[model samples]
Structures are given as structure tokens and as C-alpha cells.
Target chain A: MKDKFGLQRIRLSVQILYTILTNGYVYGYMQGKIYKGGLKYACVPGLNCYSCPGATFSCPLGALQSALNQRQIQVPFAVLGFFFLFGSIFGRFVCGWLCPFGLFQDLLHRIPLFQKRKQLPGHRMLKYGKYLVLAGLVLVGSSFLFDGFVKVPAFCKYLCPSGTLMGALPLLSVNEQLRSQVGGLFGWKLGLLLVLVGLSVKVYRPFCQYLCPLGAIYGWFNRFSLVQIHWEQEACISCGACQKACPVDLKPEQISVSTECMKCGKCMTACPVQCLHWRKIEKN
Target chain B: MSFWHKTLDKRPKRGMWFLLFGIGVVCLVIGIYEGQLEDVYRKAVMICLECIGIG
Candidate 1:
């Protein structure tokens, strides 16, 4: 019980810290301009909208797709390197601890108003959904699927619930100009947000599990991330408590780490013997 | 497994990490060389009107 309480506190603290760090410019909300300072050139580790009034940094995924869609095809080394550095270092640790959207989903999942469903139909198969979004929508669609006129960042334009939540909704609420511009796209995004809200109430991070391309990218690097969860196999009793406590239902005893594991430390709290611990991988 | 899945494989030694860091540094240097820092700053200063499907 003490461990669980500590974990909860830690999660709450991290959530609040990330929120403040990413959106530190509280004055920007009053000014109604995206914070365009030197901080804007940096990318936060999590999904933050560049257009958010308070955001001081650009969204890495947005920067990536935007750069990729350019006709000249210059490699966006900053964005790519930013992704490579952080993704390899922390993996989905940011998703579990820092992302505003991730925190929102966790909060929604805690409402106790909806029946929790760990697995929906085709749940196992749906694990690949994020990869598909990353490849087909973000990369290939941007590169090849222009309508012979203009290329759209299809993932952000059509799909990114974060952009809808942080960018579109906020802009429309504040700017009268944006209010008049709302059309089918806005309606579609609103519908998507509503559906996500409903799902998050019942499901654990459905968007992170099955939709976020950035999550998919970070997840890909989890195996080599500097911070790793190491289990002491010798101190083992296979009570299966870790699996029960895992937010995404990943079995802790599995040989391969599930890409879906966000390293949320819930499993560690749940472990009766306290066999799992976070470790910095060492140089041999 | 596809190439994507290979990315999740654990690196056996420090050499692999050095390679990864090397790649990151190369990219970072190229980005700086291309004046992308200035471009990114410029991009940040303006709101992307079309990004949220507003335009």
C-alpha cells in the first residue's frame, strides 16, 4: 500500500512538473501568441503543440513531418537528432511521466465512471496500428501522397488528437478568426477527440497504445534506452502480480520487453517481492 | 521481424551506443551546418495556420 501510494504521488508530481515545464509561459495565454522565443527551437521530449499559447517548444513529430513534406527534402537533422537522442536515452519514459496528453489519458482513466477494458477486439493485432500511422501516414503519405497540388502532413492534419486538443481547440476558443474557419476538418477532429475521451475513460492510453506515432518511435528504442528495468530472476516467485498491475497488460516475465511498456513503475509497486528496479545501463 | 522491430533489440556493448551517439552527432552537426537552427527559429516565430486545418 505504501509503494502504491508513493507511485501515485510520483506520477502526480511528474505530471505537474512536465505541465509547468512545457507550458511555462503563463503570460503567453494572455498575449494569445505562441511563445516564439529561443526555447521554441528546442523540442520537448513529449507531445506538445507548437501552436499552443503557452508552449515554449515545438512538437518534435510536427517538426519532423513538416520537414519531411518539404519539396527540397533537406534532412531535418535537428529534429531527427532530437528524436534519436531522446528516444534512445529515455524511450517511452516521457510518455509515462511527461506528456500532457498522456497525463490527460491517465486522469480520464481514473474517473471510476466507466468499465475498464484492457483488451478490445483485435487488441493484440491492433498493437501494430501505431507503426502503421508512423510509416504509412507520417512518412510515406507525406512523401508520396500529395494530390499533385499540395502535400499535407496527413497524420497531424487528419489524425493528431494532440493537435486537435492543444492547437485547434485552444486557437478556435481564443481567436475569432479561427472560429469562423472551422469546417469539416475541425468537425472531424472534434469527433475524434470525443471518441478518444470515451475510450480513455474505459481504456488505458488507447491513443498511446494504438495511435501515437511518436509513441511508436520511442517504443522502438526502448530496448536500448539508457534507463532500463532489470529484473532479478533469482529472486523470483511467478505470482503474476506485475502483469496485473501493468497499465498496458504487459507480462513482466516476458523475454522481450513489450514496446508498449511505458516504464511507468506501476509494476514495480505491484511486485510483492520488489524484484524489479530501474537501472542505468552500464558501459562494459 | 521487420527493420522496425530490430530497433528494439538490446545493444550488447558500449560500441553500439557509441555508433548511435555518433549518428546523432553527425545529424546534429549537419543540421547546424545547414542553418536549420535559424530556419527552425523562424518557423517557430510564426503560427502554422494550416497545421490545425484552420487554413
Candidate 2:
């Protein structure tokens, strides 16, 4: 009973934290004061978009795409630096807390009609799917290697629901010329989006769990990344409370901060022995 | 509704394959309607790029 109570509190706390990150801070930046000059700094953390109807800063993905596609290859100094800095410092914390699209999926899954299931043990191999997407789609498909400097943002083109929902749809809806020009490719993407939305309703974070290159990149740092989750194995009795508490269905004590674990800190609160703790492994 | 039945079922895989086949059929139909395969390729690129913001 006490454990369940603690789990509820932790879940509530997570909801509160997510609300602040998604709707409060990021939203404030989106709708806040207008700048005097041209545009503000190009990059900010947590996937908030500069072009978003309510966004304050530029989206990292969009910035990276534009930089790569530029004529001079000016090195995307600010964009690459921001990605490296944030990715190394906090790892997958951005996915857990700030991404507006992640928040959308969370809310959709919370609807009573959506069923939740944990694909465990044998299904672990599926986690490698995202790595392939990063390698095959983003690096290879986007390259256009034979054509010299022609790079496609393959992930955004084919897979990203966020790009569809936040970037393309909003911008396209207002532009009548674009609306008149929709073709088979748009139909394909719309089809893909529908499939992904259905998958998210059925499975938890279907995109992040399967094909988010950014998630795959940060997850690589789950071990050596500056942010770390440590377990006192000696203190732990394998009570399984942490596992029960995990939203992503991770076994936190066994593999805290695993690529699948979002590092949301729920398991920390669920630990009865207080064996699980977070440590800042590297300073930004 | 049984746990084993749910996990072991090939429903998701079958559904995935069916969706792919359906998409292929749609592509072929679109090609036929347009009277060529070339326009289909351009259409695909335009659509994909539209989603990615170039279009």
C-alpha cells in the first residue's frame, strides 16, 4: 500500500515536471516578448521551435537540416556545438521532459481507449531498429553521396510525426499555394503519419522506442553521459518496485539509465531502500 | 485476451505486411492513372519534401 502510494506520488510529480517543461517554460518562450533585432539565438534546448506558432528558439533538427543543405557548409558551428553540448550533458533527459511532440504522444497514450503493453525480453532486439534508422536513413539515405552535397533530411521526410505535426502541417495549412500543390508524396506522408499515430496509441512512444535518431544518439550516452543513474546493489533487495514504477517498463536497478530508460527519476522515488540515485558524471 | 496469445500472435506482422502491399497497390494504381511511372517518382519526392518543408 505504501509502495503504491509512493508510486502515485512519483507519477504525479513526473506529470507536473512534464507540464512545466512542455507547456510552461517552452510555451512561455514561444509566446513571450518580441525581440528588437532580426531573430534571437538560433538554438535552444528541448526541441522547441523558433518558427513554431508559439516557439521562442530555433529547432535543432531544422537548423541542422538547413546547415547541411547550405551552399558553403559554414560548419553549422552554433548548431553542432549546441547539439554536442546538450547531448553530452543531459543525454535523453530532453526526450523525457521537453519535446513538444513527446508531450503530445504522452497525452494521447493517456487517453482511456489506448491499451499499454510492455514488449520485453525477446523484443529487446527491436531497440536496435532505431540505430539502423539513424545509420541507414539519416546518414545514408540523406547523403545523396553520388550527387555531391545533395542531402535529404530523410528522418523528417519519412518518419518524424513531430515534423509533420509541428513543422509542416502548421506552415502548410496557412499557405494556400502549398495546399493547392499537395500530391502523391504528401499523401504518402499523411498515410505514414496516420500509421504512426495508430502505433503510438497502441504502443508506448512508438517513434522514440523505434526510430528517433536523436533518441538513439542520446541513449548511446546512457552509460558515459554526464548524467548517470547509479544503483546500490548491496542495498537493493530486488523488490521490483522500481520496475513497476517505470513508465517505459525498464528494470531500473538492473540497468538504470539504459537506452530505453528516459531517466525521468520515477524509479528513484520508488526505491524503498533509497539505493537508486542520480549523479552528474560530467560538468557542462 | 490471454497474455500468451496476445504476444505470440502474428497479427501485428500480418497487419504490417498488408499495409505495405496496400501501399504498393495504391502506387501502381496511381501510376496507371497518371499513364506513366516517371510522374510517380516526381510526385513521391514532391510529397516527401513537402513534409520536410522544401515544398
Candidate 3:
């Protein structure tokens, strides 16, 4: 139990530190302005809203959408490369340790407001929704859809709760002009955000499980990511402790190379025989 | 056995990971050369009304 708590504490600390480091533009928050610095050229490897007042780096999904939405219709190599780099290196470790929105969901899950639903109905089927979102909205809609003069970033415009919570609310709190302009669309997004917040209290990482294209993309690399969880079959005692410890209700051995494994390390701490451990792909 | 052969035989996944990492680096360089960095910066610096759900 002590080891489990210690690992969780370390993960939470890393998540907080990463959030602050990526969104370090203090002046932007005070003045209700987005950072226009050189750092904005790079995309952070997490689901942070670029429109957040304190954000110093760009959101990868937002950047990918914008790149595809341009009239010139060029490939988004930079964003693709960014995904490849981070995906191959960390996989969903970013979700567990770096993403601000993920941290928000984690904190919300700890609220103790209602009976936590360990598994939703059609959980396996529902997990595929994020992939569909990535394919339909983020990729196809951005590439082909247009709103008169400009192309639409469908995911950002219609579905991103992160934008509503981190970007819209914070900006509206300080910017009177922005508040005055809020209309039906903002209300729609706020409603969506509220629903997600409510769902998060009961269902762990509802957004990551069923909606986030970014999470879906990173998940694909889990099988071959440099950092991974290795289940040592030779030393195995099938105690079932790791499964109980898993917040997502995954069997650690079965999900050694699975997309659903967030690499949260809770299973590793729970293993009594210490069979499960973190292993770098490059190491022997 | 040679070092490379031994390593590959032990962990085939390592080779694949390095290949992907290399490809990522190459793509990033090409993107930079094409002024994609500037493009990203321009979009990010602006307060995207759509992202804020106000557009």
C-alpha cells in the first residue's frame, strides 16, 4: 500500500510540473492574452489548449487541424513528426504524466461525489469512438470541410471540452469583450463541458476513453514505445492484485502491449512478486 | 554472434523503434525547412475564437 501510494504521488507530481512548465506564460494570464512567443512554434506532447492564456506552446491537435484546414492543402509534416517523436518515446505515458486535461479528469475522478462506475456498458465498443473521432472530425473534417471563407477545425470548434474549460472560461473571466461576444455556440460548448465534468466524476477519463483523438493516436504506439511495461512470465504468480489496482480495470499481463494501458504504473506497484516492471526498448 | 545480430535477435522491437524515431527526425527537419514552424507560431499566437467556441 505504501509503494502504491508513493508511485501515485510521483505520477501526480510529474503531471503538475509538466502542466506548469508548458503553460509558463504568467503575463498572458494576467493580461488575458495568448503568448506570442517563439516557444509557440513547438507543440507540447499533451492535450493542452493552445488558446489557454498561460500556454506557451501550441496544442498538437489544434496545430494538426489548422495545418490541414489551410487553403494551400499541404501535408502537416511538422505535426506528424511531433506525434511520431512523442508517440514512439512515451506512448500514453503522456496521458498519465503530462496532459493537463488528463490531470483534470484524474482530479475530478477523486471528487468522491458518487459511486464510481468501474466499467460502463459497452466499454469495449465505446473505446473505439476516439478512433472514429480522429478519422472523421480531426482528419477528414478539417481537410475538407469549409465554413464559407475559412476551413473549419471541427474537433476544436465543436467537441473540445479542454478548450472550453482551459481556454474559453479563463479568457471570458478576464476579457470583457470576449464575454460580450459569447452566444449560442459558447453555451453549447459549456453544456458539453459540464456534461463531461459530471461524467468524469463517475467514469474515469471519459474523454480519453471515448473522444480524444490525441489519446487515440498515442495509443497506437504503445506496443513499440521506448518506455513500456514488461510482464515477466517466468516469475509469475497470478495473484490478481495488479488487476484490482488498475484504475481502468485492465489485466496488466494481457495489456502489456495494449492501447488501453495508460502506463500509469499502478499495476507495477501492486504486483506482490514484482514481476511487472518498466523497461526501455533500447535496454537489454 | 555479432553484437548487432545478438541485439536484434533478443529484441526485434528495438530496431523498429529506432527506425520510427529516425523517420520522425527526418520529417521534422523537412517541416522546418518548409517554414512550417513559422506557420505553427502564427496560428498559436492568435486567440482562436473557434477553439474558444465563440467564432
- Which candidate has the highest TM-score of all? 3
**Local lDDT at A187 for model 1:** 83
Candidate 1 chain A: 10-residue stretch with minimal lDDT: A250-259
A51: Cα error in model 3, Å: 0.8
Residue A214, candidate 2: C-alpha displacement in angstroms? 0.7
Interface root-mean-square deviation (Å) of every model: 3.3, 18.6, 4.2
Q: What is the TM-score of chain A in candidate 3?
A: 0.96
Clashing pairs in 1: none
Each prediction's whole-model lDDT (CA): 0.78, 0.56, 0.87
In model 3, state the lDDT of residue A156.
96
lDDT of 2 by residue, B1-55 (tens): 6542342232122233333334435544543454332322222212334333444
- Put down candidate 1 lDDT per residue, A153-190, tens digits, no spaces: 78877888887787777667777876887788778878
Quote the lDDT for A222 in model 1. 71
Residue by residue across B1-55, what tens digits does model 3's lDDT show? 6553343344436888887788889889889999998888989999999999999
Q: What fraction of correct interface contacts does each candidate retain?
A: 0.40, 0.07, 0.70
Q: What would you estimate as the lDDT of candidate 1?
A: 0.78
What DockQ class does candidate 3 belong to? acceptable
- Which should have the higher lDDT, number 2 or number 3? 3
Relative to the real complex, the DockQ score for model 3 comes to 0.40
